[model samples]
Target: MSALTDNTYRLLRAQVTGATDRIVKLALFETVSEVCRLSLSIDPPTDPLSDFAGWLDDDQWLKNHTLVIAGTLARLYAMPKRPWSDIDTARVNKEQYDTLLSYARADAAEAPNIDPTARLLGSIRSRLPGAKDSQTRLALFDVLQEACQRGRIWTELVPFRLVPGKQVFSIAQPGARIVMLLNAQHSVLGMQALNYSDEKIAVRTDIATLNPADLLYLTMALAPSLGADMENPATWMPGDIFASKYTLLLHGVLGAMMLQTAKPYSNTALGQYHTQIYSRELNAAPLTDRDGGLPTRQRWRFPRFA
Candidate 1:
């Protein structure tokens, strides 16, 4: 048998036999079939075991296909999904945060090709209220990076849920839908400026003359990795109960946004800040809970083909 076929056989055998759970075995089997269909550009067998046997019959085919198979599997593993747990979300967030730090420290002039703001804008343009100038975009990116370094970040998006309520209608009429706001106070921008009277004017601090809330909204639109630092929660908002949770949720949403903008298996180099952030695993400490203490440095690993 060729090396490709041999490797495939080994992987399947190991997975099928090693897994005690039937669910895991079936998932692996389905994944293998999908990868084969993608890499070989052929219709896979209805039976996964039969498909494995067929590959073994063609040594030449296997020899020519090993690399593609390995690469495709690696790419799948690397592709981000809604994280399975808060711990997983925290881990990925830390990785992305470290990448932002590196970009912040790098001399922008040295890397003429890199444009962090453009990449961030590309990911979040759909959410922005209006278009921003190049200078505004760059400034926003800088402020967010600084926020990550200082750990003054708040990460979560505002949460809303839909509910069906009784509506005045004829028989068999459907209920009117209403939105129940949850975590409405989870504002990254903090609070709105109030106009109390004509005689008294309250001037709020502005970034580039943009409203503080607007600037905060724009910063969040880019999905920065750092979330509220529990140790110094005063910056996010003193006595906010859900501050940490909001920060975690923000990182999770940013990760999801990045995945939305990602083009899998692309040949082009990741030159933008947003894209480059996911390009490699960074050596950074995983974020811990408030009582859990400071983060410890650890090495993260991704699949080779990714």
Candidate 2:
């Protein structure tokens, strides 16, 4: 079995115990939700991921999945909402990052191709002499700025996930590691990895120190404790028209909160998971107008430069 399959198998096995499974799943959900909240806070309109570079070294950051998840959450929050059709066409809009764009354009002016993109890249290369080409320089600069912005958003989101997870078993990795552990066990569940990295994984599970199977069980047991609305399954529950709407809304509120709190998968991972979820439930991936189109507008589109 692939490592992923082994992980999934373990998660299902962990779940078979009933109470433990639900508890872990819910706790996992809560940790993910709180991380998303801290990273993508509605208040003050900020993302903490951008600031990570200031406080963390590359090796430290890479091993810190909790912060990574928080960073992902911040990036998701920092994302601008735009029409799906226009996402790729919407570069930095050449307006907000005009200073950088113009600098790039002027640099490439002397190139043989004189590609505007080339010019902009050339401009960057002059300043960053070691850059091999325009694409390299541009990518480095953009990604750096983007990372910085994401770090800042994560700073706010981390506290929520940290406190709650600590209340349980010190959730260090953003929930993605838990997700990774779960999916790894259920390889046949048609699960696809979203966005995960070693640094991101390290924060949640000290893979070096913990047993995979044991950790899976512990994760499952802790899931419930992390939930904002966790309760023992009550004897009687109300059934009403409003209840249905409320349930849907509840999922939305929680899911949105998760997106804001959880780390976002990369575009490729996002697409793969979207396809996986679509295949399973077509309508369950939070893509409705009533969700206020938040899901649709979170990713960046191409055609980034003029």
Candidate 3:
């Protein structure tokens, strides 16, 4: 049994229209995951086996166990392959999940940072040789923003529950986290077709056919939070999205910096060369869409220049 499987509702498994023990456990796991992934602001947690603390112990988790149950049922009955498919009942469960998830999203900030992703990473700021003036400091922020906007240097996973019949979904986090939706995936279900604009995710499926707690995992190309003070390098951390992909972020920043027209670091030829390297490494990642066609994420690698 996984850490989440508890005797709390063992009897529920044997009742009318009962579910297997495995389905219950998976539902619990996904419920916990939805909250846990918010802090990441980057890639979704890669390993499922890793321990997630506060299991069954947290008050909110216990109180909202229905969110877990409701979400699961919505998935269960909505399946076309299942003999128990019940569209009407599924819609009711989905409505409950949607209302609950809205509350969940509202309180997302209070969710524990299992990996502490919101913490500052000084790696990028550390690259700039102690610039004395505010201008140089802000330049660092500007260039990073530009590089991120120019292409998908790295990707972030953001999961949100689907609201049935909602026409357009916004992934915009303006002034907070700069991100573009490179691709999207549906939990339980697979990759969803994404025709996005202004971070509005438009998928191919009919909304009524989907249920709430039906998670849509948006693979976003992210820029770290820009709300930090430009004058204070200590405050300039790049969020967890860049945690494992520091090289890609650095290359993008450096390339953009060198290409700046009037900056002290401007070196057109060198900038173009570094930019080329940035592009190469960006494409190498197995899951990132650096070129806007098909994103990969083989880990954007960087080579030291001679």
Candidate 4:
């Protein structure tokens, strides 16, 4: 099984056993909902393979089936909604890193052709004159790989937006919310870095210590805590309170799975989680009426100088 599969299974098992904290529980439930949606997409009427009950009770079944589940989660996690263009850039960064690494490891005659005009590669070439040395080249290759990994995580964590009148909810909404939960986990660990761009909100974190599976679980568990804050009628009214309650219950299970900490769950902690989540979710302008026609006015375009 892949490392992600193994880790995801373990974290899921922990969640099942009530071993995580409250914030994590919230996120886990949300992640599970996403997994269910993916499963439905695979086979809507009778997805026997995606049945949670079949794998939940039996440890062996859970282990055997996790690869598909984990892979789906990872793919969903990596996908970007409309209006978010950075995901493609991250993918390109990964491809470039892989290409550079292969070249660095290969003999000079075996090196692959790389476009000098590529933005990332151009920046590296300009800064490191001696990058031709095998060791230096290899080091540079590693740096790109690391940077790409970070970029991948960043793109995955941020949700894409659509122009007003395009869609009520961004296609990437669920994944973005899930990423918020993960960021909440990072905030607790003192590792989250969130920033806003003109197009979309972006997030970064020190996730080197987190396993893919652990990260997934953390994200899953954090969603509920965030929803609870968002559901407040004074701040943001919930469309369906019953559904929200059900979600909160699922998150409660996730919270139970967390390692016990000295600080108790209090209003302060709740506020902290809420603040972290809203910081990202509320950064963008409010969604305009979906039924409205697209505006005819053309926005100004800036020219780039070569």
| Candidate 1 lDDT | 0.31
Give lDDT tens digits, candidate 1, residues 37-127. Answer: 5433446557644444453235223222323233323333333442222344344444543443233223222343434333333333433
Ranking of all candidate structures by their lDDT, best first: 3, 1, 4, 2
| Candidate 1 error regions (>4 Å) | 2-7, 11-32, 49-51, 55-306
Candidate 2, residues 103-183: lDDT per residue as tens digits?
A: 323432454444333333334344433334433432423322222222111111121122222222333433211211211
Regions of candidate 3 where Cα sits further than 4 Å from its true position: 1-130, 174-179, 187-195, 202-205, 224-229, 232-237, 241-306
Q: Model 1 clash pairs? A: 155-250, 156-250
CA displacement after TM-score superposition, residue 94 of candidate 3 (Å): 63
Candidate 2 displacement at residue 161 in angstroms: 54
Cα-lDDT of candidate 3: 0.52
lDDT of each: 0.31, 0.27, 0.52, 0.29
The candidate scoring highest on TM-score is 3
Worst 10 residues of 3 by lDDT: 297-306
lDDT of 4: 0.29
**Pairing residues by index, what is the TM-score of model 1?**
0.20
Full candidate order by TM-score, most accurate first? 3, 1, 4, 2
TM-score for model 4?
0.17
- Model 2 regions lying over 4 Å from their true place: 1-22, 42-272, 285-306
Q: What is the lDDT of residue 108 in candidate 1?
A: 24
Taking all chains together, each candidate's TM-score versus the true structure is: 0.20, 0.16, 0.38, 0.17
What RMSD, rounded to one decimal, does every model reach?
Answer: 22.5, 26.1, 21.2, 26.4
